[model samples]
Target: MSTRPNDTPQTLIDQVRDATASGRPLRIAGGDTKAFYGEPVAGDTLSTRSWSGIVNHEPSELVVTVRAGTPLEALEAALADKGQCLPFEPPRFGAASTIGGVIAAGLSGPARATAGGVRDYVLGAQFINGRGEWLSFGGQVMKNVAGYDISRALAGSMGTLGVITDVSLKVLPVAPAEATLVFRLGQHDALEQLHRWGGQPLPINASCWVKDATAPDAPELLFLRLRGAVAAVEAASERLMQETGGVRMDNAQAGPDWAACRDQTLPFFTPSSAELCLWRLSLPQTAPVIDLPYAQLIEWQGAQRWLWAPASAAMAIRSAAAAANGHATLFRAGADGAPGVTRFDRERSVITTITQRLRAELDPAGIFNPGRMG
Candidate 1:
């Protein structure tokens, strides 16, 4: 079991104080597994690995508080022992991923649309702001309304707001039953089916549609997962398979496939060329097929879409996403690099002004992860 070193908090506090006094930027890192995400930050490293351990867990209360540097796998293991889980299913890009990095990245897996996102599970947090002050917001219980919004905001802040020390999150018991169904349908048809089922009282947990590249002729396939009470899952499985002419996928094969999709290890995620960049489009679930000429893997019913395109097509992709009432992000830059393409979309003036004001208030010295969100 990982243990939190007694001096870790004060050590970090002193480091932040020194950095603030000298006006030097500090890059807050935990495990460094997600270093590839967001814009690169140039600064002296402030590692959170030493402040690691589970602080509190109440099985009955369904809440766990852990030091930010605790390994994500460790926390998950502890929760599994209690038959509880983080419903958002945050992706662990690497074995060394820490809970802190999970919150900073704020990326969720397939179950996100139904189970919610990282921000939804966050109950509270403790962190060090730019003024070298240690502050805490919210509380361990869900009913604790004080400063809740601020704590939730830290979930996807990418460490630009402050150095997160620890966080409290809500957990849910593992579903009593689960199953996966496979359907051979094109993107449009699969999305239509998903939308229809989504409006019903089904146990639908996640849905993924992608072309099977390994097949003789690449055919689009939809993989759907259902989780809930045993009766609910079983009933939904039968109804979905009957209505969609889908087949049941054996858990032995389906489990790992879902995991692969979550961690982005599926064959579809593999780039065919170094110049191809991975773009993530977030649209309304009802958004129709985009007109862009690129292979896409649709998830979250239809709210999230992934495609590989060159940086040269950035404008076209962004335009299509915006036209669909959504936005596109350069999730992963190609090996050849995107000469001047920014990772995130440009926020409107109002949102930008609010973000700037928040940053100024929290990180007054601008010493923490400067330009990380851009």
Candidate 2:
């Protein structure tokens, strides 16, 4: 992949200004790895891949400022060199995944339940709004209060608000020790145990419960990851195994499995049939197992659930989510496609009004990613 030399924000500003003046909708794109995420947008492509590279790095301060189009792999490699990592573990769907796309998509990996979400690490942002004017929020330091909340809000905005030019993200040193424990338990038992452990001072960083499709009898298994000081991890691992009859996994063998879970490369993510759509249900961690009849994978200590079912099951799935005081998103359409279903759940009237007002203020012309989030 050849790098483009036009790494300055001026180039993006000029393009946005021209688009705004002509009243033409512009679809913001950085590497386009997450193009399937939201509703499709009809507009001329506005590429940000050319505006890439790290702007600054302060290892001691645990913050790195990088341009929007910088490759997510490159940023992770740089941080790894300094023994630091992004705590949220944002998923890189492919090698082409960009830092800007990570923020816009606002998706996090396995560690999300314990560490934080994409918004938590964002400290500042620079973007070109709908009018093609360069606007900035927050600052490089964590304590910079002015516009801090707004900067964080950009995470997961799906580029509907503005074209994110660059951002400063908070980083953390990698944990000293880690362990994965596996237990053969059903989904309900697994969730119950996780909830029981939640009240304890255990160093549980991530959890996943899935049925082994390849196994002879397809037993449901719970995988737990513990990360922290060496002593803490070891102690917790031993106690949990003793109490629950769990088996400790060799990191050499378990590391890649965890990565597969994070990146959704696990076999479970693959649709068994072309008609099955992928639905993501975000619920309270304490919510019980959903009574839906479909293949399911539970993550985030039960806060995030992935289910495979036909689009015809949309009403039942959405109702179940709503009953749990949560929301469901049509994460990925099946090969047959979900014709009329929206990707996102409808917000409450108040939230809908506030969202409309925010878009109106920042993207007055509605020229940026017109239908991407709708």
Candidate 3:
């Protein structure tokens, strides 16, 4: 069956209703960048490109609402104009990333440790559920809420739960000043420093790895940023230098470059045709198993890692990661290859059951994101 990217909300709903009743499963695709994120799928597809807009804006109230299909670039521009931004610093692959895509992926950057994840700032979302029935949850006002906080549940749910039409997000005023202090240390020292700062009453906005080609031993060059008043940043700078033995905060002339520290589309992303695959792993802060033929780059203060391994390395890597209390995802390479390794660290038995139940209620026909998530 063929479907046009319907423009109006009701039109989209009607389109989905008929499609679902016929036992048809709809695959919602946005921006098409994260297509490799979940299990591959071949089915009816609905594009949110037609349903785009910035429904509301209240600069004073620190919130903005937008259509699911609206590009994140547009949202950032709109917020910049208001001296405000998405405090969590969601990742954008390029110019075409959309708000809907951000929520679906449920990704957050370095600031996530300081502020919160993509779900925290979400005030509400409107979507057409798996059954093709229109469902609206949460709302625009900062504290306004739905019967259930289903709006946020939709964050990492991928599109398996619903087709997000529009969303209301809590925004933040841009920090008056920003700065970073780089610490060149090996794992033990780096983690120690990370912990030291973690215990301090300072402004450590972000931390990440900037792999240094010259030294594999010091593969991790940690970068930390500070936000807010110049004076506070200065004081934090002093405390940082004193604690880390003098690697002080410079102007961070390369602050923006550090922004790419998360969702880093490094050389890893290119040669887009490479049979190589990129996987995102979420694990416990301290996971002991560290066997890897692949290079490991981490963010979120080591809670999240991006592991690039051979397609065959999937299961071995996933097994190792699972033992360490984390999960791995086949997020890059095309799925045509027999996933030699586990595509995604299979969830725990408990989580597996819950996810199956939720999938049944959301995408009962298994129409949404077919194989990518589980």
Stretches > 4 Å off in candidate 1: 1-8, 213-216
List residue ranges in candidate 3 displaced over 4 A.
1-8, 213-220, 245-252, 267-273, 286-293, 334-340
Give me the overall lDDT of model 2.
0.91
Kindly list the per-residue Cα lDDT of model 1 for residues 1-374, writing each as its tens digit.
53443434989999999999999999999989878677889999999998889988988999999999999999999999999999999888888889999998899999999999999999998999999898889889888874337888898899999999989999999999999999999988999998998899999999999995446597789999999999999988998888889999998999899989999999988988889999999999999999988889999999999999999999999999999999999988898668699989888999889889999999999999998888
Q: Evaluate model 1: give its TM-score.
A: 0.97
- Which scores higher on lDDT, 1 or 3? 1
Q: Candidates ranked by lDDT, best first? A: 2, 1, 3
Which pairs clash (backbone N, Cα, C closer than 3 Å) in model 3? 38-372, 39-371, 39-372, 315-341, 315-342
Tens-place lDDT digits, model 2, residues 1-374:
22333455788899899999999999899989888898989898999898888888889999998889999999999999999999999888889999999999999999999999999999999898988888779888978875337788899999999999989999999999999999999999999999999999999999999985546588899999999999999999999999999999999989999989988999999888888899999999999989998888999999999999898889999999999999999999888669899899988999889878898999999998998888
The per-residue C-alpha lDDT of model 1 at residue 228 equals 97
**Whole-model lDDT per candidate:** 0.91, 0.91, 0.73
lDDT measured at residue 22 in model 2 versus the true structure, 0 to 100: 93
The better candidate by TM-score, 1 or 3, is 1
TM-score of 3: 0.88
Candidate 2 lDDT score at position 242? 97
What is candidate 3's lDDT per residue for 1-374, written digit by digit as tens? 11233445886787678777887767787787677566667678888877777877889998888887788888889889889999989888777788999998898887887788999988888888778777778887767774668899889887888888888899999888777777776655665666666776877777765454335664456777788888998888777778775464556454656665655755434433456677777876544325675665666666667766667777777777777877777766644554555456666799888878877887777767676575
